[model samples]
Target: MRLRRSARIRGPGGSFLRRPPLRVNVASPIELRPSPDGRFLACGDQVGWLRERGYGVDSDGCRALELYEALYLVERGDAAALGADGAPLDVSGLISLGSKRNPRFLTKYIVYRDLRNRGYVVREGYGLGNDLRVYRRGEYGSRDARYLVVALEEGRRMSASTLGRIYLRALNLGKELVLAVVESHGDVIYYSVSQFNLRRRLDDAA
Candidate 1:
């Protein structure tokens, strides 16, 4: 299936996309990461830093931060109380926290988790010469499923067919037997549903 509607995502990490006619409730730039390697950008809303203010403030930001942390824990397949971000929500005496506040950690964590659940064998950092890579289960040869070759845009526009070929070759699929796309925008993420068959395309080409 195709992406039903594109989300309105823009900022430092995104190239110029045709702006949507209507506004959408999209997360701000702070919510997204430029790449997995740039791990220093912080996205918390100042709740975790209140302890530095020195005693007696309500620490409401701490509560929201804890909530987000709890959500992240659930997404990471950890038990709800493992305390992925803050101290154990159940305990009252200790407050363990992450030294860095970059929200990109959460973004990468979510993307990897979602793709893994979608039956893709995901490779996190660049793979086999491709900047990013994904594969469907089954034999490696014969190009039996779709793959995405992710790229940041350059000045010129490239055709979809070119992208499809690059993805196939980078993943060692040999020829034009795979479904692929060059996803240009970093923030506008895409997910594939495996109902589409690459074997059908290879067979059609043959």
Candidate 2:
């Protein structure tokens, strides 16, 4: 979906309020089916629309939406991907399914929603050691993803080695590593992580 440019609007207090980019409405609700693999949601029709919005991958003839993408669509009321019972799922219902599928759904959803609200195009970060791959606004197809982002809850403990490994992977892939921390109150803060190599200094002749 194309995002409308940011604009300023008058507030109740007569102060100008800045509006974030708005996504264009989908023509109609897209239909999604659960794949037998259980790793993705498949759409038999309107696959092109989903693709144009950077939602999923085309497998054979169908578009396969990532679990996160399906959840996001449900949240936006753009699509009604069927559940196991072949019924449409609401946001909460989708969340339940996602949580059952992946234990980190809550934290990931917080970070995903935050990024989308900021106007970035986000997709699953498969094989990238992150939760989402983000493309800057207006740069989805023209350029590669600018950032690979991982979500963590505030004050959550992570081993230094794990962080180092993620940093190294991002470095190797030429992508920036972003850590999105969701606080208890649902606020999010982003940290950029990168690796720097320092050459050892040679000792003077003793």
Candidate 3:
């Protein structure tokens, strides 16, 4: 934008300054739709802030929101999921459909919502139904993903091999591995995981 040399008028020898801009915060609901493949929710300009805030991935000229992201936005009163029928889906309604779409939907949603509420930006993870990519509080969109989060339910048993693979993936991606456990009582607990070189430790001890 080009700055005006003078935004004034010679009225009564001197013109009064224009009224200051209204720097008020106005909340507008965002609109979104399911992608053609039904795997993601497509949004246009309404998702600009969401994209900047690391909500979804880019698809053509729009951003695609996953079920968990959509649910979070709906619950936050910032977005609405418009169905094919052109009607918006309510939070409870979306949860019902989401559960059917993915068996671990609630667990994933719980972790995702909690992370967002805790001031982190979360994006899709490397593994489906396994993890999420997270950014530090103020580093989203400007820095690499800081955490590779693996979501699990309390009391659920995961094979060590599977965890090893996830750890390797995070290591290769140069991110810290985090395990997010959702308790039966609907609380999320986070634990940081990292590789420990036992051989090196043993040699040092010897």
98, model 1: CA deviation in Å? 8.6
Supply the global lDDT for candidate 3.
0.69
Model 3 lDDT tens row, 21-59? 231221776777877665456565555776777877788
Q: Using lDDT as the measure, what is the rank order of every candidate, best first?
A: 3, 2, 1
lDDT of 1: 0.32
- Report the candidate with higher TM-score, 2 versus 3: 2
With a 3 Å backbone cut-off (N, CA, C), the pairs that clash in candidate 3 are none
* lDDT, candidate 1, at 196: 40
| Candidate 1 lDDT, 1-206, residue by residue in tens | 23322333232333322432222222221121111332212235432332232111232232222322333323332212333343333211111122134323333333333444444544433332223344555432334334553432223344545444554564464222222222334333453413244344445555
| Overall local distance difference test of candidate 2 | 0.69
Model 2 stretches with alpha carbons more than 4 Å out: 1-24, 39-45, 127-130, 196-206
TM-score of 2: 0.78
Candidate 2 local lDDT, 132-191, one digit each (tens):
888988998899998888888779876666676777777677788888877765566787
| Model 3 weakest 10-residue run by lDDT | 1-10
lDDT of each: 0.32, 0.69, 0.69
Residue pairs clashing in model 1 are 41-102, 42-101, 47-61
